[model samples]
Target chain A: MARASGEAVLTRAVRILAVFEPDRAEAGVAEIARLTGLHIATTSRLVAQLVELGLLSRLPSGRVGVGMRLWELGQRASPTLSLREAAMPFLEDLHAAIGHHVQLGVLDGTEVIFLERLSAPGSVVNFTRIAGRLPLHASSSGLVLLAHGSHDLQERVLASPLERLTPATVTDPRELRSLLARVRRDGVVITEGHIHPEATGAATPVRDRHGTVVAALGAVLPNDGRAGGVVAALRAAAHGIARAHTARTSDSH
Target chain B: MARASGEAVLTRAVRILAVFEPDRAEAGVAEIARLTGLHIATTSRLVAQLVELGLLSRLPSGRVGVGMRLWELGQRASPTLSLREAAMPFLEDLHAAIGHHVQLGVLDGTEVIFLERLSAPGSVVNFTRIAGRLPLHASSSGLVLLAHGSHDLQERVLASPLERLTPATVTDPRELRSLLARVRRDGVVITEGHIHPEATGAATPVRDRHGTVVAALGAVLPNDGRAGGVVAALRAAAHGIARAHTARTSDSH
Candidate 1:
């Protein structure tokens, strides 16, 4: 939608890229134009320019996907690289211990963006995917991050309408407030069937060197009493990740 | 460098982001200004704009680093995500078997950009970091990809001035040609001390469903004579990655 003659180039580029989502990673120019609400000619031209810059590439089906260059640039610019690296070993341990989905997620705005996730083919019907997002009020990782997030962020989320994903998703502002407080007090949260009818999410906060809660280490498992143990395992792994993160950051400094 | 009015806006934005590297991940406005060759005031304004967009964020020390949003955007668009996901299980297995730095890389332009790496703290002295880049001729992963790459790309690399990184780096055109030929024939490349004197890089090509060499799977280890076993492990892992990749692509189709 940034075809205005005087609009910033970066804004237009971001708009074009913003069209690609988890479910729709590749799209033809016509679909992209429709989704971005940009004129077909303008979208085509911008796409061409992006391809030239290696920010986008053509797929075998002639659809454009994010280019390797963007990935390289993101690799350089993505501030989460170190955090993800720090959390990887612990994530592996947690995955082996839990035998379900193990994920490391960071709070971005009011949502949790998963940086890494380890899963098996038939693991627990978990909705979490690497680079995917989930609402802070519903998902376990989101709950942990939001519990340790800024008051302003918490207030903003509370003020906004919490969209319901599944029937069990906690959407009431009052219920969510209490949930956030409990997550803070207990150092963990286990929400049952928020994303699916038969899955439960267990999460714990992961801190940085400065003791700032930087991420949420979490697991998605079948709804059962097993979440308590998963929470303990998650908390232990979170502690390890936080220690590793601190060590790496301090070393770099 | 693209500050000229009416120039591509994305180009200018890229220039600002291009200033950040693994070594220079966090930078002050003045340094970024110098690197991007933009006016100090202009750089600051653009930086502010990018920060507002969450493409960049200010660090605790008041310097700018890549924002989580950029990583998120990169995650969505980057073509390497599927490849990285497909290769992870095998990479972990290879790492456990070899106890060294295992990495997956893809050819971007003339360089090999590493997408993921698994390593222990005191593993081999690796110059390769996740999302880091190495010159095509100086890294084993690069050599494998280049060997299987197009004739045009091979010719272009040979024609270019190859900058030597270490004493073992092959810069001579005739020598490099033979090496590339050997890698194609042998289905693997073992480069010793091209990046660091104590490290040896052994790599093999990973194919997609259509049997296209889409990436290079490799490992960095001590420059001892024990490369044969590592090569065998790498080839097996590469085969696994290719199978997973093909399955994924065929599923998506």
Candidate 2:
């Protein structure tokens, strides 16, 4: 057996855990080793350790899967869940007021990870998945988060590969840089980008007490060009969320 | 510093992470050591290892807090997040139909941990928090889970202390035992327990394809003495969630 540093142990544990995504829930030890590029013996040993800790569990059929213990720990640490709880009443109002797809998202590694979404019956179809990722340059919430993100983060994202989900997606780094600047000035983003060719979305940044952008609240409408009202509603909802966050924090302390 | 076994190291790591709950998000090294009953040196070393792995992060004010990386990894492993995604549509429908608080919870340890909750404005005020825990003998979802839980789990919860949250809470072990039996045979739990005297909740078990209870779906309503309609709606919604879960798994595979 090979000896690993304490840091290596933690990193390997995280890598092993990351192999289970929304699309892929279960995997065999050999598959995990291949996916994580760890030696088979090292992978198996670490996995057995995790199973012992109750962070992972093996099914009777022999495939290893994420255990309920991991889920419980994650649920405990989820700020997204807390934010959703705080914003639910306001989100419900926004959803009813807008009568479209209402979503809340936060920036995660240059992508927008949706925290909550409310859609009406017979609303436009959306590809966004809960706990799923979307390109920062393509979605409305992503645009808002990217615009408010730090300069270094913006540059890092621009330097990375920008996947074009639709023909209208802005893949040019320079162009996206300027667009983000305009979004910062306007405090809103109205996009008809890659997600739904026949749909448009308006997003606004939800801020904290120090005026830092924490998340984005947005609404998606059909691409028939009636977006001004939806944009106003989204901005109001975002402002309300910021106010609620401030109030809750102040009261808690 | 004292050395720990591989299993001990993993358990210690989990204990360190568990110290940062929703209420206590940040703490210093000494505080964590005191909370977990570990030596200061050992706690500091473990915290450093976790920070290096991005599971914990150092705040600007010098306190340690749970990191976004931890949140990301946890989100990946969360079965509740996946189930919530599948059940959101149905939950929304049920909430709309009933105009009340619709919630989803799962068994965690000896308590019921709320996974997701959807409530409209003017709904009954209940003290259920997302990711918060309630005793198995008190909450409606808790009862449903306890009824369907393994025999060991039942014995463990029964043998432990059952705190009474309200006058109506079933703290008597004998009574709780009979209630669990009734819950299993009836397939639903309608109770005015633990939360409020004015609120009644009806919960039903959500089964996976294997017919094992994976979760409990319930609705909280004002106890205006109308329980029959709410009970029927909760059972239907639970069935809907189970069907959706099966469909989602089949589609993913």
Candidate 3:
């Protein structure tokens, strides 16, 4: 058989890897072929190649799952490493003090992608998980990121239909634009029941040495009137994260 | 030009990704070509394709670094996810109580690969990082894992030359065998200055529902006379992690 183009093969490999989600981490060649819409033979060949490279592993049950080597390589030089490292101590502190869920998020395209999350047993309900994504208008982290984002990003998000995750989610473009302005002016956002009725998300922008927003430090708390104290705590943690990131970046260089 | 074999191309892609390290995250095409020993044209083409696949990203400085998508995908369905998640809360509590470096590690091949580490400012000197590795004989986590590892794995590792990382590192095969026996009997191991003179590592095994040692919960602390407290703390945390993992696994299944 003729070899596929290198680019096409790599793209297909990515598709194969992407099919393994948290809930469905293992798949047989047939399942992979069905998921990726490739022929069974092609899927078998690709899965074998991936297994050879340690990007996928065969389970004892003969199914394949994401390999540890892939996780190692992805983590060894992850772009979010420095930020996550810097933010972790502070996130832990905030999580301990607030006894809820604390997280760090960054803007990826028009959505907010969480880099880290710390949760306690019986903490407030949190919809966001590590490596999870949320719409720009529906999450407080996304709101903080969008508020400090570039003009192009702001326009792109504004032009797109805002997904309303809950009744409190701001779906109107004009209201969102003004809310973003307030986030910029006030430097913090508190969304009550924006993503879930039982939870509240409060976030503030974390800046770098150049004063550019690099991430959002947020907390998910019970939808109680206790958000007043959380905003101050979130701001403090965000400030600490920014300073820590700057120091870490300087040390690395 | 003829396209490379799919297997060769994937191997080359793995090599390219492996070249980026925590300290040296970004590299230009020339440097990547030099590092991977690939033709400059081939390196450039593969890099461009990786960028398109979002496995690598081009920085504003024109150098490339591991992309956000790579981190996201690696974390989404990592084999370590369930273990890490189950251990995180316990690790945090231990970190808070000990005010030192708390980590979770699993035996990967002949080495111990840390899946998570929590460190405090001005904490004890620790040589490990998230996704970092240490030899089986020179780390407390490694010793704990090796103690309960498969007989074949144990024999192979023992037969291999054990590099002495420090004066305290047990390099004598007979002595190491006895030490492993002690670890198995005691359910914990402590290494004083095995990897760093200023620090000590103490670890205990975390078991799954089947009572298999799945991970090691450890702490890096000052090499003072305080290992007693740390050992108790490590055991407690390991027990908590194992129970949490059992619960989580059952829930997921």
- Name the top TM-score candidate: 3
lDDT of 3 by residue, B1-253 (tens): 6658888899999999999888789999999999999999999999999999999999999999999888877888998898999999999899989999999999989999999999998998898999999998899999999999999999998999999888889999999999999999999888888988888999999999999999989899899967878788888889999999999999988
Clashing pairs in 3: none
Question: What is the C-alpha lDDT profile of model 2 across B1-253, one tens digit per residue?
Answer: 5446555677788899889887787899999999999889889998998887778888887889887677766566565666877787778778888998988999877888887788765788876766778778888999999999999999998998888878989988899999999999999989974567888988999999899999999889888778768777778888888988888778766
The CAPRI classification for model 3 reads as high
lDDT of each: 0.86, 0.82, 0.92
Interface RMSD of each: 2.0, 2.4, 0.7
The parts of candidate 3 lying over 4 Å away from their true place are none
Tens-place lDDT digits, model 3, residues A21-130 = 87788999999999999889989999999998889998999899999889988998999899999999899889888989999999998899999999988998898888
> Between 1 and 3, whose lDDT is larger?
3
Per-prediction DockQ: 0.60, 0.49, 0.83
| Best-to-worst TM-score order | 3, 1, 2
Query: Which residue pairs clash in candidate 2?
Result: none
TM-score of 1: 0.95
- The i-RMS of candidate 2 is 2.4
- Write candidate 2's Cα lDDT for A1-253 as tens digits: 5446555777788899989886677789999999999989889988999887767888786878887677666566565555776677678778878788888899977889887788765677676755667888899899999999888889899999888877878889999999999899999988874577887878899998899999998888887778877777788888888887787778777
